[model samples]
Target: MKLISWNVNGLRAVLKKDFMTIFNELDADWFCLQETKMQAGQVELDLPGYHQYFNYAERKGYSGTAIFTKHEPLNVTYGMGVPEHDTEGRIITLEYPNFYLMTVYTPNSGGELKRLDYRQQWDKDFLAYTNQLAAKKPLVYCGDLNVAHQEIDLKNDKTNHHNAGFTDEERADFTKQLDSGFIDTFRNLYPDTVTYSWWSYRFHARANNAGWRIDYFVSSRDFKPYIQDAKILTDIMGSDHCPVELVTKDLI
Candidate 1:
């Protein structure tokens, strides 16, 4: 099975770019998206042979996520059942017979760390939610988690030490999540790889290759065997973020 996750920044915007061409080329069994930034009825897609699911934020043109999959899930759920956190429409979980697949767009710690406290709470709650699913079956969750994780995950680690995605608090929270029996698929596969999934649109960041590996495919430790390979498709262009992939053996 091929699973692809991308932070499109904005689905409508990218659709105007090379999204359809790139999406067709990847041809994943499961394609998950983050930061869709639109509500229902705003746009319609023409993806053949895929079941689509979306969680739209209460606020229009804000944070949102979507999943398009070849296989129909046994069940589909939106949000984590946390009222405060559910407003942003950041998470969607699709339950199959053998495993659960989730897509999340974790909240960003806003300018000057204004939203840091909220983001920390989100991390804790999000981890708890994943734990609940993993207890029932193995889980594969992906999206822009909004953290650089470690020095190697970002290009300007020293200068970005206190930035939103690179802050110590955010990184520690991600570490806590990983410690709870989950594997960061790409890093687990290529420990020394320095490729990044997200680059700022400022200062010619992409051209300079100054980026952060913020997007990811994470799975339960016991599910590791199914993950044949993980990749950061840096060459793909459209959004400020590139798509990340996980190639897996059949689960069903």
Candidate 2:
């Protein structure tokens, strides 16, 4: 099975930028998206063979997530069941007979760390949610987690030490998540490699290749054998973020 996760930044915007062509070329068994930034009825997609699921934020044109898959899931759920956190439409979980697949758009710690406290709480709650699913069966979750997990995860680690995504608190929370029972697939596969999934649109960041590996494919540690490979598709162009991939052995 093949899966792709990307933060399109805005689905409506990308649709006009050859998104269909790029989507067709990747041809993943499962394609998950974050930061769709739109509500229902705003746009319709023409993905011929996929079952689509979308979770739209309560506010229009804000945080949202989606999943398009070739295989239909046994069950589908939106949000984490916490009203406060669910309001943003940040999560979508698709349950199959053997595993659960989730896509999340974690909240960002805003300017001056104003939202840091809430983001920390989110990390804790999100981990608990994933832990529950993993206890039942294997779990594969992906999307823009909004954290550059380590010094190696961003190009200017020292310079960005206090920045939203690179802050120590955010990094430690990610470490806690991985320590709990999950594996960061790409880093687990290529620990020494330096690649990034997200870049700032300002300052010619992409042109200079100054980026952060904020997006990811994470799975239950025991499910590691199913993951054949993980990749950061840096060459792909459309959003400030590129798509990340996970190739797996057939689970069904």
**TM values, all candidates:** 0.99, 0.99
What's the lDDT for residue 66 in model 2? 99
Q: What is each predicted model's overall lDDT from 0 to 1?
A: 0.95, 0.95
Q: Write model 1 residue lDDT over 1-252, tens digit each, in one string.
A: 899999999999999998999999999999999999999999899999999999999999999999999999999999999999998889999999999999999999999999999999999999999999999999999999999988999999999999999998999999999999999999999998898999999999999999999999999998898989999999999999999999999976
Model 2 lDDT on a 0 to 1 scale: 0.95
Candidate 1 regions exceeding 4 Å error are none
Q: Give the root-mean-square deviation of each candidate in angstroms.
A: 0.7, 0.7
Error (Å) of candidate 1 at residue 223 is: 1.0
How far in Å is the alpha carbon of 161 misplaced in model 1? Answer: 0.5
Instruction: State residue 127's C-alpha deviation in candidate 2, in Å.
Output: 1.0
